[model samples]
Target: MTGGHSGRQAYTGVPRWLYALAVLAALVVVLPLAAMVARVNWANFIPLVTSAPALAALGLSLRTAAASTALCIVLGVPLAVVLARGRFPLLGLLRSLVLLPLVLPPVVGGIALLYTFGRQGLLGSTLEVLGLQIAFSTAAVVLAQTFVALPFLVVSLEGALRTGGQRYEAVAATLGASPGTVFRRVTLPLVLPGLASGAVLSFARSLGEFGATLTFAGSLQGVTRTLPLEIYLQRETDPDAAVALSLVLVAVAVAVVALAYRRPGGRGPDGKAGKQASGERPTTAAAPGGALT
Candidate 1:
């Protein structure tokens, strides 16, 4: 049977103080956002958000976020696949290194990117010699976003892969399917929901990126300024417009996450298809021992 019924009972043993703490934690996050919403000038919300500069910033943010999300999928999928399936020395260290961006401060990441791609920097000098400039440009915005957002996709996809296991893949290989065929037809389909969720999260993160974009991309209107950058700039001049834009961003992020996670046909949070909804237990492949591997 599914844990939906049992899960409620399992939580009954929790101490009452834990619930109080949880509420306090929730309030800490919710109060600020509520206050920001309250500060928004509803009378001019539409005009504030639709101003020429606001429109340009919003458009650029969307474009760069989309591009960054695409780059994450393209580069992160292979990295996740290797991380999940490959066996190698120092693999754990490698995984930690790959995920470093997730924990590193955004400004530090921007500095790293600047050194790697800035003119007179590592690869930046080579590119400059070839008549290409990256730092302080729109491309830098996308790159900075991808640098910070890639780890989200990797972590999500890698976790999904680890949980889903490799039984189906092994079976496909035993049946004479080539590695490529099995990956395309079986592996990819199985992890698609996870990939979709990761992409949405990456997009949301990209939309909200600020420190790195400002540090590296240099917020030129209609060129590199994103919504977050716009909001930061507006905070100094027009707090009302800033509040309105912040609310817009918060709404979009909430909608994107909720829409992505809303599974159909009784699918559960685990991304299984209808099994949990039907009160069926999710399957797990056992290891050589009786316990889970």
Candidate 2:
């Protein structure tokens, strides 16, 4: 009886410390966000947020972020599918290269963009011959945002594809479903949660992007100036408005993550499934020889 009580005490005591640490970590993360919210004046919040420049910046931010996210999905989904399931020499190196944007400083990314798209850049001469200019325009802003946000979408989708089993896909194939049908009806549904989560994350990251947008796209109001740019501009003049704008960005990011959490098939970290279907084809099962399966 004594041994049983001591064992029980040991098990319970270890978790208590862990619980305390978790609470402390939560507090550390939440306090700064709480402070930002508390600093805003509710009375002037509406007028401050509704100002023409603020509204324009917000509109551009949303439009560009949405457009960039769409582009990321179009370009990233295939790359992620390939990287996650395909086998090739230097594939590991390729995956690491894709994640460069996530680790590299945004400023460095902006500079890289300039070298690639600037007037004297490698492709710049060709673009100029076609009477096209990419620098410091609305299109430039979208391109810059897309460059920074694409990696988030790709990485997230790859993880989803890896963990969301291919059992349904295999079952679909056994039922004589066409490759396109299997992907559309089976694989897509299973990874829908990941797609949604990745899109939200990409949108949030695009909206908050500052350095790259400013450096590559420039900070022209009603053109390339996004919410972050607006906030930086306001900081030197109206501190309250700056704080308010910061709060709005924070609120939007939190709302996106909250919505992701509320999505269907949303599982907690510990509740997530392990490895998805291995031996599945990199492409859809419809291809010849059924390589993608």
Candidate 3:
């Protein structure tokens, strides 16, 4: 009995070497971020963060990220719904295409954007005719951010839509609710968590966006330079200031992830109405043929 019990314990246990390897992997990932944060001098941190260029970059990063995140939600949510529920030929191909940005290098994405929007680009002449220029401007920064960050939102929303099911929506439809009404009243609430998480991730990604923004918007102080741009520029001339800015960006990213993982009911201004609609179940109705309706 003792031998059997010992064998069972061994089978259920993780090896010490495995735990050590896991810890080492975590340290490898975390040590660089810790070093960046630890290098910030408290005495100079406030002045560095408040410097003119830093302040401007911070504001621009926030504004552009917010705008991009808003755009992602407006455009991505509908696409996510279609991808999750709608039936169409080549749908699998379309889904893979949507996720291309996530896998593409940002530098490559930036170059592609330049080719699509630069002076000699397909639409560039038309835009110039209308007195609009996208290249090397604040508008370009927002566009770059939106392009790179949109896939994150779409993937998250699609996962939520698939897992959350459409039963409640069907019930609402049976009760004579319009399609839009069913979406707003049933579907939206079920997927709010995923949307919120996706938006936060997109915002964080936009805040740290570099290669694409640099290529499309150019690094101009108080115009298109964001916090990440400021950090890169400072690294060549002022390492201390670079560290300070890096710390700030890291802090913001950490805060966003932390808030996203917090308990849903306990909230301070960020919680939405949909978070309260957690009790509904997926529909179990069937067609006359007895298969999934």
Best by lDDT: 1
lDDT of 2 at 216: 89
Cα lDDT listed for each candidate = 0.86, 0.81, 0.83
Model 2: residues with Cα > 4 Å off, grouped in runs: 1-14, 171-181, 263-293
Residue by residue across 1-293, what tens digits does model 3's lDDT show?
46877766635568999999999999997999988777888899999999999999999999999999999999999999999999999999999988998999988788888888888787877898899999888988999999899998888788888876777777667766677766776777678878888888888888889989998889989889999999999999999999998989988988987765566455322323243445546344454544333
Residue 167: error of model 2 in Å? Answer: 3.3
- Looking at model 3, report the run of 10 residues with the lowest lDDT sum: 267-276
TM-score, candidate 3, is 0.85
Mind giving the per-residue lDDT tens digits that candidate 2 earns over 151-262? 9888888888888656667766776777778767667656666777788889888999998898888999999999999999999998889989988888898887776556
Tens-digit lDDT track of model 1 for 1-293: 36678655534468999999999999999999999988989999999999999999999999999999999999999999999999999999989999998899999999999999999789999999999999999999999999999999999899878877887778666666678877887777777777888899999999999989988889899999999999999999999999999998999999988866886775643445443224343343344533222
Comparison by lDDT, 2 against 3, better one = 3
Sorted on lDDT, best first, the list reads 1, 3, 2
Task: Report model 1's TM-score to 2 decimal places.
Answer: 0.88
